[model samples]
Target chain A: MKKHLTIALDAMGGDQAPAVVVHGAHLARERYPDVHFVFFGRSDDVQPLLDAAPLLKKVSRFVHTDDVVQAEDKPGKALRRSRQSSMALAIESVKAGECDVAVSAGNTGALMALAKFILRTLPSIDRPALASLLPTYKGECVMLDLGANVECDASNLVEFSVMGAAFARTVLGLQRPRVGLLNIGVEELKGNEEVKEAAEILRTSDLPMEFCGFIEGNMIGAGETDVVVTDGFTGNVALKAVEGTAQLIGRLVGDAFRSSWRARLGYLLARRGMNGLRDHLDPNHHNGAVMLGLNGLVVKSHGGATVEGYATAIGVAIDMAHHNLIHLITKDLGGVAMDRQESEPLTLETDKQAESKSA
Target chain B: MKKHLTIALDAMGGDQAPAVVVHGAHLARERYPDVHFVFFGRSDDVQPLLDAAPLLKKVSRFVHTDDVVQAEDKPGKALRRSRQSSMALAIESVKAGECDVAVSAGNTGALMALAKFILRTLPSIDRPALASLLPTYKGECVMLDLGANVECDASNLVEFSVMGAAFARTVLGLQRPRVGLLNIGVEELKGNEEVKEAAEILRTSDLPMEFCGFIEGNMIGAGETDVVVTDGFTGNVALKAVEGTAQLIGRLVGDAFRSSWRARLGYLLARRGMNGLRDHLDPNHHNGAVMLGLNGLVVKSHGGATVEGYATAIGVAIDMAHHNLIHLITKDLGGVAMDRQESEPLTLETDKQAESKSA
Candidate 1:
């Protein structure tokens, strides 16, 4: 039998820590018995709950760490000072080859810092990017650098496209994923100088992904592109805006349903469909945020994630490990580099002509 | 009755031209008998709509212009070549003192270019900003540079804050409108170089608005800020993301209601509250995109706006004119230059303490 992927998790992180993280671990263990978890943090904080579970004992290990990086800490100073932080140690375990993957719901900046410092970045990658899969009408769209690198140059976006496409293929199971640069408009010269320069590089890059040109925020959720790339600042804003609006509208709908007995009946009747949609659109279900272009697998959960969110994150880590995503990314990008060196100037003109007319 | 603010309308512009514009003019005129519109286009194109409606004849005046700017045309070339374009003539009407304001539901770039060329920017304003009122938990929030200047520096954002504040105070009736720089975090030193520099400048800018420090996208709809200023690229992405999420959630709820009989009953029972919410969240109710920092008043309607959306935009323009928004912006910013010469070093220690505590 194939061995389950071993993942080191920071159990002391997030708003709903210990309880939610413990619940998540139980759910994941039940679903994937082959998976093993090493819960890192203060054992005193978790012993009572850990002592209560029998099945959890068979699937889990624990690493005691006493420190944590606070959310409000200065990124540079906190990352430097928190040598014994559970988040940092969890990632280090992956780097030390003790685990296949690491998961954290701690401070995002600290996670990114620790991942970058310990796991290191892949070749041809200036800075590793964070990518998330968002549900859309057609299917899920992958948007990268969702708040990793603040200022990205042309080369940075090209790297994001390649990494994002590699992710879509390995995790999302897409073939030749179409990549797009996020801009204010779809027009070629519609954005700032950064975008204009990036478009030129992406158009000519020998990356395995199909560079689908520029896309707008409205188009991102509409599933116009399989992989969308943008600098971290803009991506973060866009991601948060979508999240905020969804929560607002969800609240509005919930309030409407509870307004009267008739509406409650309507909600009851629609419970099945609502459940299907709830399963589909729930961020908790798609909790894992992959730190792409990194040497090892790392997932960051939301700071306020509940138990279900952590379990979903573990599931994502297991999936990535099963598919050997890191090896696949290396192979894909390596092949692209090899092809670029051997081949003559390819028929980009044909591609451009085809791009001018599309579905 | 107070006469409606006379706004010159570029009738030949937009996707559903002549029809939407004419229908909007009639609707506004009927609803608010004081409102008046001056339509500029090939008189023949607009005359047909007016020929059918006696009420439109009462609300609108026609000006003949032979040229029109297509959405596809390059903005710079379009503005330079289409000297006799209806959109240009409409703005010129405002500059020529023939109208109180100019309204267009045209190619955004072309409209911006024409407004800048014809109306010119107000003194002390580097670039005019497109400030749109977004519905939030706390009534409405002013989001500026929603796609005006793509590239902006520190000084540009300070100017945006001044102009946006004036609009919020005069148009939205916000008192001491709290202006926040849109950044990734609330920290004193966070975000990109542009945002950091802008935050510093805002600290000392002698604008009439209250500088409330940094605000992130999630905090926007939470009523933490009254006016949020960012570079155009970020603002545009945020706005589109919010709009897209609302649409997606709307689709999900509609699907739920149609999925089962009980859900249908629930929807019917909740119809009143749901309707209220749908109306509250509708983008049309917040249709005005005021071009702040311009010497003359200019408002833009969405290119694909319905007649109702156009009417709301007209109402917004009327309100701005009535509040003397243009004169207020000029006075506030103009006074800054004069105040610097007149006053001694304004010790803002108490203000800084308040800001630090708030941060």
Candidate 2:
């Protein structure tokens, strides 16, 4: 481990940027005493906020930048204007070895684009997938390719299985995570060509994980496996739908408790236990989504996540960096056949193609 | 309307057949006094059960069929052996105009194949989509192609929108339903080629419903639209994922209430409200899935549905028949651009083609 582990922050990103970014850093500092931050944003806006936290200001370095990537900016537009932007500079720090990892709560598409364009993916990596932790019946399970690639081939899915297992190991602290590829049915005859092909490869692969075969959508939140893998489109829809279902349940539960006087009184008495239920359903409980397959760790927090949520994102970056999640993935991926396409040298042609595809 | 509304029952289908079928028929009889049942099964097995319900016996007719379609029968094998199977005979009754609709709690794939083969799709309809009502915040919303087609083209999605709108209008009683095509993002630029093309057509098509553009998976249960449409692959995954989420919430709620004595006491006091919440989230609340775009009505009840739930499936069939859902779909489809492909000549070639696709 380095004497000082640095986490680069896009201070001006997020819905409540500068403020949440500073406060979240302060909270993360309490958790990791040896951690340092390099804040990349307009100095005038960030300097005053850092002043409020003497401890954080003591270990943090400030770099001024005038460019800001708007939340509505598309990936292609954001990449062209990336040179002076806080998000780009923060990621640049990682590529330049100035920081161990980069953390941002910026436009997800832009963050993904800039990270891929600047740092590039690891060797043999075609695309970096978005990985996040979702609540399940047993506890929490990791799901990957959560909108990174709209469509994925069999090789992409196989790569996802390896990456997802590494994530579960480092983030969730499991030695050999049980991995599953999401499909409509568990039978061999079910699902599309890609899913069936992926299953066949995973069944034979000798990766450092237990391949539990196919998992259906309903079985996702049931905690049937440690890691659920799928194409970006299906994964993204299922994740958001799960979130929506949780919210719907919360709303209905509230309505039920307030339906009558006895129910209202009963709610007051059971407020503690009810609060427990709320905590379980809350998305903020485990807040960070890592862009796996990248050469350097890059974590994306929810744009509208709270102070604690942003801090939790920083925690993920720290854990991955400390535990060497990148090294683990590199070793696991060595055995698998991953296509080579994009490169580190910044070329407009390649980046533009990736930006459009990632868009 | 016919003086007597006849509903065909695959008296040997479902987890609890004959008994549940007869009892469910009795339940529907109470709701609609003009309804009659044509039960197709082994008379030896079903007649004794029917005799227990004298009122149901008074208005029902029995057709002996020793052969039965096992729950695990594949559609292709079942189609070849369907001549004497109870499910096939029940659907044949609909095609022969002996019954207004067919209701079964049997294997969904076999039911869909046999129905499509026997009755065929309406003119200009490429395939019949499986449509069902899902609970939402506002009330109930209809979602279509819930695993009927593994893949769909642009025109198929448009036809689903038309069929889904008709369903919402008849089943949910919405005068002019608001429709939304399921996509990862609400943006026009987002989603696959087929989804975008469907949106363009629906945007300008003078369909008898409101087109609300793209709807993400999260907004499905939020009741943002009365009808949501998607390809079968995505639709089936989302539906089951939603089911998993609901079950997770139910289990968590139970655990929370049992956490403490106060919570348990509170739950007792709020029992009525809790029960209401349970009923709202229960799949049985909206029991039937209709094979829309077909010339005849076919309702699929959950395999494990109770007597009440089976009756609810019958209720959906009765509503569609009373409202002339088929006639409405035929008229609405006349204006839309739909491709015609499959036919009802009972040829081995055509039925085999659809059987493989539907499988």
- Candidate 1 lDDT (Cα, whole model)? 0.81
Each model: TM-score of chain B?
A: 0.88, 0.93
Query: Residue by residue across B1-359, what tens digits does model 2's lDDT show?
Result: 57878999999899999788888999999999989999999989999998888998999999999999888888898899877799999999999999999999988889999999999989767778998989998888999888888767777899999999999999899888999999889999888767887898788778799999999989988999999999888888889999999999899999989999999999998888999999998888889999999989999999998988899999999999989999999888776643333222323454565577357
Off by over 4 Å in 1: A335-359, B1-4, B334-359
- Clash list (residue pairs), candidate 1: A266-B266, A269-B262, A269-B263, A270-B263, B4-B34
Interface Cα RMSD for all candidates? 7.1, 2.5
How far residue A197's Cα lies from its native spot in candidate 2, in Å, is 0.6
> Candidate 1: lDDT of B242?
81
Please give, for residues A38-123, the per-residue lDDT of candidate 2 as tens digits: 99999899999999899999999999999999999999999997768999999999999999999999999999999999988988
* Candidate number of the best TM-score: 2
